[model samples]
Target: MLSRTADHLFWMSRYMERAENLARLMDVTYQMSLVPQSEEKANQSWNAIITLNSLEDAFAAKYPVVNGENVLKFMVCDSDNFSSIYSCLRLARENAHAVRGTLTTEMWETINYTWLEARGRSFDQLMAGGIADYFEWVKTRSHLSRGVTVGTLLQDEAYHFIRLGTLLERADNTARILDVKYHGLDHGGEEGATDFYQWGALLRSVSAFEVYRKAYRDVITPERVAELLILRGDMPRSLLFCMNGVVKNLDLVANSLSGETARLAGLLRAQLRYGRIDDILEHGLHEWLTDFMDRIYLIGDGISRDFLVPMVEAA
Candidate 1:
């Protein structure tokens, strides 16, 4: 495959996954913001929002207050915010446009129509008790596009690259989602009644609330929540599940020159697969999450160096 085509496929899928992740994260943020918070917890929660998106300076410049409404605007509706859902969909559509011939008609239509429909959105309208609905729509649209891609596209290198992007993006997101609460809650103390709600909210943000119940069959606890989100393979949004998919796809896409890509994927998968939640906690959840995200970056870079860059050099 051409380097340009591979790049487009990889990035298009990444953008889609990013958009979905932002929507879901925003949903959780909104829900969490409504609850009573300690001064310390409130500050930590608001800071996590800025840090998670890596937009602290920009957000501070735009809004002096880091309240729920302002954070929602920065995350959802700010066109200048490159990581916003609007920009993600725009970039996804643009990348898809460059490789229109490479995508199945259904795949193209799903994303293209999503981008087009998003054009008519009024941010003000959505803020009036409909933002949650808007976030759900974004998630639904992304799921539709991915389902179409899986069902309609040929299972070739293009599909493999797409899968690589999706899983890597998802792995990064799951890690960040898990870490968002690391500082927001006091983990060393007995589980307070409030801790139960906070922990349950964290699980629900990733759509893991019911799955958490099904897996543990006990009341929610920080340790169990971490274990369920981090190590459980059956949890679709779990870090290990996403990493497992990334490794599988990278293996399928591997070539003689692509050893580094597959190796990194395998290494990370092994680390997560054999990892215990207790180990992660002992190491510090923030540190563990930071390491996971950094490794994901290395794996993505390796893919570009091995497969994507070689084509560029040849051309």
Candidate 2:
């Protein structure tokens, strides 16, 4: 396959997945913000959100305060923020359009319509119980795109690359969300019913609440939640599950000159599969997750080198 086409196919899926995650995060944050808490505590939800998305400085420079409305604007619709939902959908559509020949008609239409719908959503609309609706729309549309691709596309290199991008992006988002929530609670230590609900809400944001219940059958706690999101293989959004997909898909995508990417994925997969959440916590979860994210970035570099379009140096 041509590197340019591969790049477009891979990134289009990734940006779609990223947009869904951002919506999920924003929905959970907005919901938590509405809970009856002290003024100071309600603001913590927005603060944690900024930190989670790594938008503290950029967000502060654009907005004077860390409130629900401003953060939602910066995350969901800010034209300047490339990681925002609007930008993700716009960029995703542009990429998908570039590879329109490679995609099914259903796949193309779903992405196009999603982007068009997203552009019409205003900040006020999202804030007034509209964010939740938009969240459902983003997730449903992304899932539809994936389903169409799976049902229509051929089993070839293009399909494998799409899987690679989707799983890799998902793994990073799941890990980062868990890391941010864990650290936020550790520092804030607002224990009680409110804290319990916040913890469960984090699980629900990733669509993991039921998985947590089935796996543990106990009340929600930070440590058990970490276990569910990090190590449980059956939890579809768990780090291990997503990394396993990367390993399996990369193996199929590997060619004579490009086995390195598969090897890296396999190594990461093994580490997580054989590893334990208790061990990670004892060693400091933040340190462990930081290392994991660094390794993920390296694997992303490997993927680009192996398959994506390369940049040429100026003479």
Candidate 3:
């Protein structure tokens, strides 16, 4: 396959997955904001979203405050914010269009229609219509797009690249959400009602709340939640699950030049596979997750260098 086609397919899926994850993040943060708390605590919750995406500078430039209203507008529809849901859907559609012939009709229509609907709604309209509803709409549209792609698109190299993009993006976002929220919450001391609610919100953010209950059949705790999201292979959105998918897809699409990239992905997967949550917490979850994110970035760079567009070294 041409590297150009591969690039577009890879990013189209990535952007779509990113948009859905952003909706999940915003929804959870929005829910947490509704909980009764001090003004400072509420502000901290909203600000955590900004920090999670590393959008502190960009968010500050446009919005004077870090409250719910401003952050929602900035994250949901700010055209200049490349990571905003609006921008993600737009970019996904554009990439899909670039390789229009490569995509199935169902796939193209699903993405194009998602962009069309999303582009028509402004932040004000989203707020007026109920932001939670809009967030659900975004998540539903993303699910539809993925379902269509999986059902309609042939399972070939193109399919492998799309799946790769989704898995890698999911892995990065899962780590980001877990690391940021874990630190932001009061986990250094004893667990309380507030901590329980915060931890439950975090689980629901990744649709892991029920899984947590089933796996432990007990009250939510920092350690069990961490284990569920980080180590449980059965948890669909778990880091381990995402890495497993990444390794499988990389193997399917591997070329002679992609051996190193595949090896890097496998190395990460092996670490997660053999990893224990107790050791991760002992070493410091933040430190461990920081290392994981850095490695994820390296794998992304490797993918670009090996399969997509090769990055040129600075002169």
Candidate 4:
């Protein structure tokens, strides 16, 4: 396959995964808002969602009102915001559309339907009925698309590229969610057992709540949360899990460890495997996560260099 084709397939899946995660994050925040928290706490929830997406300025310009309703509208329906759900699904479909022949019919149909559904709705239309149901629908569709991509696509270069993209995006989002939890806690004071609820909510935001509960048997400490998200190799969305998947895909693409792709993946995977959770906590969790994210970003660049972009001279 051409490097360009690989790049597109990888990015197509990445964008779709990103849209789903953002939708899930916003959904959790919106649901929490409906509970009886102080006005200040509710606003913080909205603010955190905006911050997580790194869309403060765009969000500010459109939703100067900045309440739960307006924030949801701006994030979910507004196409002007580049990371909005509508924009992401549209971009995902467009990328897939360009390579229709390379993908299965189900892959194209899943993403195309997602694009249509998102494009056809107005913010008011969503807000009028069940808000949670709407966000859940978006997430469900995104999940379905990913399932179709994995189940239907052949295990060739196309599938590897898409898998790489999805894993990379998941790694970054997992890192960001960890950082957000630490920051939110440091700034927002503890509310007794409410911290447990909040911590559980954080897990729920990443859809890790049930996994976590099963693993620890109702024990939800901050440290355990950090470990589960960052160090657990079995959890699909964990950083370790993502890194492992990415390395496997990178190896499959480049076909050998001599290339830059192999070297980059090996380096990052080694770091994840060797690093201890206690060490991360002893030194500093936030700084550790920040460094980990930076390395992942570097790995992404390296992958693009070796696989997505040609290394040959421009004759």
Candidate 5:
């Protein structure tokens, strides 16, 4: 396959995964905002919202008024915002369109239909039936597309690349969400009421509310939620699960390239395998999460260098 084709497939999956994550993150943010904020909670949530997506500068420039509506619109629907949910989905469809023949019929159909649905949504209409409903719709479409891609796509090199991109994106976003929760609760002293509600929102946002409830069968706590999201390998969006999936796909790709991508995969796998939950917690969650995200980006760059970029393209 041409490197260009592989690159497009990789990015196509990354963008879809990113869109789903953004929608879910926003859902959690919206719910958190609904709970009455103490001065600390307000400031923490505001800062968390800005830093979690690295949108501090963008948020300042786009919205002179830093309120919820402005933030939500900018993050979710602003066409000018490159990392917005709408923009990610648009790019996903465009990338998929570029290498149409490489994808399964169902993959193409799913993305094309998603694009068609998004194209019809005007800003006013999207914000019409409450932002919650709109977020839900986007999340549903994203989940459906992933299902279609996995169920119908062939298990070829293209499939592995797609899985690689999706898993990488998932690992990064999962880390980010955990960062938001960790930082917001790190100075935990006074905001007990808001903290509990925020904890519930965090669980629900990842669609792990029911699973977490079934497992714990008690009140939501910061430590328990962190354990569920980070250490639980069975949870689809857990850091362990995403890292494991990436290792599997990268192993296949490394075999294809005769071990070119092996070091990158090996490094990440070792970090997760050897490190314990206490290590992550005791070392300060924010710094640990920041380092994890940096490593994920390095892995992605290595993948691009070894697999996506052709000699001519590099030239």
Candidate 6:
């Protein structure tokens, strides 16, 4: 495959996955904002989303405050924010269009229609229609796109690249979400109602609440939630699960020049596979997640160097 085509295929799926995850983050943050809390605590919840995406500077430049209204507008519909849902969907469609011939009819149509619907949504329009409902629509559209791709596309290099992009993006977002929420909560001696609600909200954001219940058959705790999301291979959105998929897909699409990228992915997967929640917490979850994100960045850079267009050419 041409490097340009590979690049488009890879980022096309990544942007789509990113849009879905952003919706998840915003939806949960929105829900948390509705919970009764001090004004400062509510703002902190909203600000956590900004911090999770490392958009502090960008967010501050455009919005004077970090409250729900401003944050929602910035995250959901701001055209200038590259990582906003609107921008992600637009870029996903643009990339899909670049490689339209390589995609199945269903996949192209799914992506194109999603963009068409989401193209010009204003914050007021989104709020009028119901914020949570709009987010649910984004998630549903992403799910449909993935479902169609899996069902219609051939299981070839193109498919593997798409899967790789999705898994890597998912893993990165999962780690960020967990790290931000875990640290944001009060870690004092006992769990309170607020902590329980916040933790439960975090689980629901990742679609892991029910999985947590089934696996532990007990009340939600920081340790069990961490264990479920980080170590449980069966949890589809778990870090381990995402890394397992990443390693598998990287293997499928591996070339002679891609050995190092594959090795990085494999190493990360092995660590998660053999990892324990106790050790991760002992070492400090924030520090551990920081390292994980750094490694993920390296693996992404390796993938680009090995298989995708070079930085200069892409520029």
Top-lDDT structure, candidate number: 6
Ranking by TM-score: 6, 3, 2, 1, 5, 4
Clash pairs (backbone) in predicted model 2: none
Determine the backbone clash count of candidate 6: 0
**Model 2 lDDT per residue over 1-315, tens place:** 988898998899899999988888787777777667777766776787688667788887899998777877888899899889999999999999999999989889999999998898777776685678888888888889889989999979999889988998898888877876776566656788888888888888998888788888999988898888888888888889999888888888776757877788888899899998789999998888888888888898888887787644101
Error of 2 at 296 (Å): 1.0
> Superposing every Cα of model 1 onto the true structure, what RMSD results?
2.5
Q: CA RMSD for every model?
A: 2.5, 2.1, 2.0, 3.1, 2.4, 1.4
Q: Please report the candidate that would top TM-score against the real structure.
A: 6
lDDT of each: 0.84, 0.84, 0.89, 0.80, 0.81, 0.89
Error of 3 at 237 (Å): 0.3
Candidate 6 matches the true fold with a TM-score of: 0.97
The reply for model 1, stretches above 4 Å from the true place, is 38-40, 186-191, 309-315
* Candidate 1 clashes between residue pairs 3 or more apart in a chain or in different chains: none
Candidate 4 residue-wise lDDT, 123-240, digit = tens: 8788888777887887799789888877887898889999989999889878877776686676545766667777877798788999998898967889899989888899888988
lDDT for each residue of candidate 3 in 1-315, tens digit (9 for 90 to 100): 998899899999999999999998888888877777788877887888888788999998988988988989898999999999999999999999999999999999999999999999978898899999998898899999999999999999999999999999999888888876776654553257877887898898888888898899999888898999899999999999999999998888788898888888999999999999999999999889889989988998888888886666311
| Residue-level lDDT tens digits of model 6 in 1-315 | 888999999999999999999998888788777778789877887888888788999999998889989999998999999999999999999999999999999999999999999986778888998999999999999999999999999998999899989999998888887876765653552258977887898899888988898899999988999899899999988999999998998888788899988888889999999988899999999889889989999998999999999988888
How well does each candidate superpose onto the true structure, as a TM-score?
0.93, 0.93, 0.95, 0.90, 0.92, 0.97
Sort the candidates on lDDT, descending order: 6, 3, 2, 1, 5, 4
Can you tell me which runs of candidate 6 are displaced by over 4 Å?
Answer: 186-190
**Reference-based lDDT, residue 132, model 6:** 96
In the range 1-315, model 5's lDDT, one tens digit per residue, is 677888999999999999889888878877877887665565566567667777889888877766677777787778888888889989999999999988888888888888788767777787787888888888898888889887988888899999989999988998888787777667763457767778888888888999898888998877778778877878888888888888888877673553645676677677776677787789988898898899888888878877896545645
Report the C-alpha displacement of residue 250, candidate 1, in angstroms.
1.2
Indicate the residue-level lDDT of 64 in model 4: 66
Clashes of each: 0, 0, 0, 0, 0, 0
Candidate 2 or 3, higher lDDT? 3
